[model samples]
Target: MTFTRFVLSKRETTLTVVAGLLTLLGLAVVYSFPTWGGLGGMALFAAAIAVGGFPVARHAFRELWLSRSLGINTLMVVAVVGAAIIGEWAEAAIVVVLFSLGEALEEYSAERVHGALEGLLDLAPPVALEILPTGESRETPVERLAVGDRVLVRPGDRVSVDGVVRAGQSAVDQAPITGESIPVEKKPGDEVFAGTINTSGALEVEVTRLAADNTLSRMVVLVQEAQLRQAPVQRFIDRFARVYTPAVTGAAALVAVVPPLLFGQPFWGEQGWLMRALQMLVIACPCALVISTPVSLVSAMTNAASRGVLIKGGRYLEALSRVRAFAFDKTGTLTEGRPVVTDVVDVCTCGECPEDCGLQHAASVEAQSSHPLARALLAEAEARGIAVPGAQDVTLLSGRGIKGTVNGANVTIASHAHFDEYVPHEPSVCRQADELAAQGKTVILVQHDDEVCALFGVADTPRASSRQALAALRARGIHTVMLTGDSPTVAEEIGRHVGIDEVRARLLPEEKVSAVAALAEEYQIVAMVGDGVNDAPALAQADVGIAMGGAGSAQAMETADVVLMSDDLAQLPFIVQLSRQARRTVTVNIAFALGAKVVVFALVAAGLATLWMAIVADVGATLAVIVNGMRLRR
Candidate 1:
């Protein structure tokens, strides 16, 4: 029976176990065998080889079996057999051992970098409490809960369905889905998503979506599908090795066979032809070249994970390094995504007002709801410690604004159209608000007695360091672009503020994917950065997708190759630089390893290098390349 466990769970402990075994076995073998290859000599190999070997053997077998072991392992077995048949047992053992060790190192790197998807899965809402025939609640696995099923979401619980709050009010840490840094306030009729934390308060929710269709499940499905569909870039090297092994083996045979008989040289003489061929086989293992790229990528990725970034795999890391363009989603990515009041306007005041009546009126109207805007206004009023009086006949116009009577003042909070009946804007405030609106700010109108009394300004402003990150990317020659569902006025405004080279506004989710596809035609690589539900498709379509894990939408963050845990953009440019550095390091290692093998093979053939020297050249060069690639973990 197979007992499977995650590779990362046991690496340190597993390595320790293997090392102890290897130290004992190696010591026993050396002390018992042909001239004790040195107890001291076995120690280093026991430490490096044993620790490096098990991982490789496991990975190679897993991949071979997963891919069905069809032909990938065939050529390798053939190469090893050919060498051993010709009396090169030690060389064959080294070849197999080296290849296995290399495989493990690559796997080790991957294990280190993976995200806590399993832990995230633990956040799935348990049995959803459904309304029963007798007016009581019945518990069922979320999967059994169907659309239109009324469910109860308690305080400090995760919402299980995507729907509207039929009753009750509360603040939700939507950070689970939206990656918004702060909590979002929710009230009756406001849209709520599943897999989000119910920070405070409780509510009765009408299930508008089935459990399978809930936002959390959708994200899980999307992420899994994307991963399955992603092409395995590392497999190309394996395929290359299969073809490469036979050809190299044939060359070594020709070097050993044809030349000796024709030149009247003895097969096992002091300048033995058979011996030289064995040296060629030992040097031509190709383990170093095959393992180079995947190892460093795995190492850096694991290192990133320990710090909170969640990159998908080696291919994404490779693509990220080659990126020539970077596109950002405006809200909850570059910006905080927590809408806050920035300005205030007043009209219809009969005088004797201490504060901006527009501000007070707007705040008063906004005090009744928990939307980002509602919270923004409410917070501002509260910060000023403005006491709020409960309103009567409060009516919510979803996707618009709300209306009610606050202390018989007949107050209304609305959009631009709603304000036209009450107050008129001066050129300066109008112009300024228009400018601010263009930059992605949300503007609300506060009305009193059929006149626009004040304007409340709100926005999910950019992180203080985003502009600087954009500047750095531009300097690196990567084109920076922005995409969003926000109004053109807002998108363009955000684009301008963040110094984006292009802005595509009012895009639906599908439109964002099409946009990324279109851009891929001209750009070498496009990295998408987003924060929410709207950003999911775009995140999947881009050549390289980075999510702001801390403040991005749940879907966006989970699907991204690179996730910045701090919800800040300052980490972005640094990630880009590190990726480039990793790629460069890999290239250098490959060049050094391959270049050395080619030169040494040529020397051994020309009789310029002795067999002992050949062994040194092969092992020495491979060790150097391996050491060089390990530098990426730093």
Candidate 2:
């Protein structure tokens, strides 16, 4: 900043500068004996006090008279008045200046974290290119955009609203929301969030949310709310200060009067106890104790947010530090949740047929169905270069199977339930299906008339990082459990693949909640990670609820105590490590602040600590606390 700008910048700076000048002029003139003598020195010191101490004294008076409060400001005012009574004008001036400087430093450290939050506001573009019905585009403020409006986002532009891509193909960087290092591919019907950059293609997006109602806006609101929450240690310090200040005041009063009266000592003598009382007041200031833990927590939260993990508040962060067990929902949390056909086995016992004949018949009928397993069958057939013959007179069998005529012969593709319910199959065929189901595959049988033709095996694939994350948590001695609605066989298969320590299968939503409560009872703190609406109850039941891929599910994001934006399991360990480190930092800071105060207060009571030593101990401890808290930012 320039000299002119610095002078005009902040009220604190302006006041500090003026008061600093007054103190320097008074000190210089008072020490130099060639000036207008002691009378001139006293007047200059009084002028310096008026200039430097007005704000502090006014605040102290207002708080005491209006709120009946005994704050640190009140302590400082009392000390300054006691110094003036002892004719220690230079000490009074120094106290006022140093107190102001210490407060400014504390404020600067606090604003540093708040400034990181303000950076979120700059991620979104102020204007958006609206697509008009007349086949033209107009630049419009994002605030004017409503739901269902169409907007054009060119390559390298930030998406201004949460919406669906109507037309486009490109990799959009979602690091701002999900913390994923890689850009995600966006195509027609894919969802996009606000503030993500469109990297390589122009997109026509139909906005599904208003400008103010997007995910980014809600996150900002959440972050602001988190900052306002106080940690347990911070609340303890606040309660301590409310009592400590008034107790210190009474002690200082007793030190100033009782000792002098009982010992028959003069009140204004060079050896008077007034100076000792003033030193105690300065040393007992709770500035360091009150600011330590909160600053550390705020810095930790801001740092976590920057890294793509959202910790709801200090309470959750504290609980996360103690988490000894982690429960994860199976689908979408540990696996891809998309079923794919893995194998096709021919078991036809009827008349001889072509090698891929059954698959060809299954694909022909599945191509017309919209079920997830049907799509998987069609995709597999397409990949195998098979031609699907047209089907006629298709009949939907609800949850059983589909029946249709492919080239004059009837083909039925059905689940095991269908055969068990209607057309009972041979023991060998049923045994083969059971064997496939035992291996966690969804078995679908294709029947040609009364004979089984082919069997298709499908399963949800586990993510590439699932095993590594589970192992990392296990290495940290954290118990890992999987909760899923799948059958016991299927859940066991998936849990073993991810190396989970425990697996609970066939769980209903209420059962999942009971499992979470059971874990909580076994372990003091447990965290649950899930992505679907069904996981909401269990999430709320856990000590800390973490949602995976929160970018897609608003309910998951809202319900979970912590949301991993990237939907990646790797971030889970990183979050736990960071939270543990933050908790350690807060502990160290509190220890340092209290330890320093105890040593200084003892010296003051023994009459060995000087006024200069008291000031250094108070202000220096505060600066150290601020610096220690800021280390989490890195």
Candidate 3:
């Protein structure tokens, strides 16, 4: 955050400063006394090279002898030695000085980017306000707080652990974790993550995860791991560099020996090809080409991670760039995954219970179940302050519904299809259920004994950002598909609302995987985005799997190739844009690096370029590509 923090370590800084001063002094002496031509001028340049170039030369020797590897350091040291042999001390000193300065600049830039990431880690407070059972609070280190420990988050304070709010209502600003623009309302039982700020009210939250296991910590770890992962192009460059350095060295040797020996030029004359060979050696360093893709990938990945997008590796970023279609799960992905009671209609004409008692009977029977529809019914009953009596012998009829005994009467809550089996004569109730199903609402027929009690309609609403996200994908010419266990009517209704191009409904977990495979076959690349345990299969089956981390299950996160650390669907488009930009930047860098080297190589071979010109071309190309790659970090 300060200028001093941007300064690198004292050792490196001192080395660079001392080397720069010596180079400047050497240049002053050479230019001021051009007629010296003796030991005096040679001593000045030699001092500069010894002081400024020793690090590079020493590294070159170590790598060459220990690992038998030829790299940029080897190229630089060889170029310097060849220049000295040809009595070109001024050029050698300048090359070493410029190379040293470039390394210093690279080190500073890397530190700055890493410093920005460290800022994210500092957002979490080291201590927490632990609430004690004796009605007292104590400040405790975050590391000592175990799971289930109660922590009180005061207004405007950052939440220190991931947990469900035990009490109190407040608006939490989750922008740091989810990139959400608006503050989210949280109350008892609602989940809140670490590093999120509590905007209003005091909240008592029971810790659900340890400090090191929080979402923010996981994001940082994943990004660090991602940076270490090599892309396909980067791996190829690594292999190429292994062969490239020695090949260029051989080419330089041939240039030094072949022309002077065969063409009969005086070996030690000014017109000799030895000088040209050294220039070619300097020009063919390949520093720019080797660094082109990785720097860009690192910058882009870090930037995306800071914005709540976790691209697991460079390969996934490459895959994301090629994605032509995206498949999404319906529940917990497109929809809110929480059903609300939409309509409660009267279907009881047999007078088994009072007309208004239909909801009470349904609520009483459903209170014993934990299904989504049952939760909706219980929630509605609680909101209306209706008393739900306890039920006995509650039984789950898998794929159908529940049957129980409530208040000494047999009660059955089942899907519309089973309504006829229980009440075969109730044609009127069946017709009403059909009408509600046509409107994309799930209808549950409530029966008391053999008589129809009521019909309950439940529907899960789509997320606010789903439509915009799908529209953005379509604008980019990428297809969007919806895969869900919901029936055709419900799936199509939600898919249409979200502008999805295709809908595959009533799919089991395995069927969802098949759907992703089919999409992959149709479009060479497919990305699947989901936020549930059931979605793990499809997510893994897709070419690129993206999980919504905020609401997603742990299994989905582990199985996904990329994790959107936020619930915001807008991250979908942002991810696509970032991946494409990274790929484009890398392509341009490769082309520019290779093209510049080829042009300079031609100039050097034809004796049209001096050693100074070769150094400028090589180092300048490297600096240009580095700056271009750093642009993504913005």
Stretches > 4 Å off in candidate 1:
1-233, 346-349, 356-358, 396-401, 422-441, 448-453, 550-554, 608-612
Error of 1 at 86 (Å): 9.9
If ranked by TM-score, best first, what sequence of candidates would result? 2, 3, 1
Ranking by lDDT: 2, 3, 1
What pairs collide in candidate 3?
Answer: none
Scored by lDDT, model 3 comes in at 0.83
| C-alpha positional error of residue 562 in candidate 1 after TM-score superposition, expressed in Å | 4.1
Cα lDDT for residue 567, candidate 1: 65
For candidate 1, write residues 135-237 as lDDT tens digits: 7997878877777778888898888777788889998877555445678788998777777778888878888877666655554444343333322545666
Highest TM-score: which candidate? 2
Clashes found in each candidate (C-alpha, N, C closer than 3 A):
19, 1, 0
What lDDT tens digits, residue by residue, belong to model 2 across residues 139-250?
9999999899999999999998899999988899998888888899999999998889999999999999887878787777777788777777778888999999999989
Model 3 root mean square deviation, Cα atoms: 3.3
Worst 10 residues of 2 by lDDT: 1-10
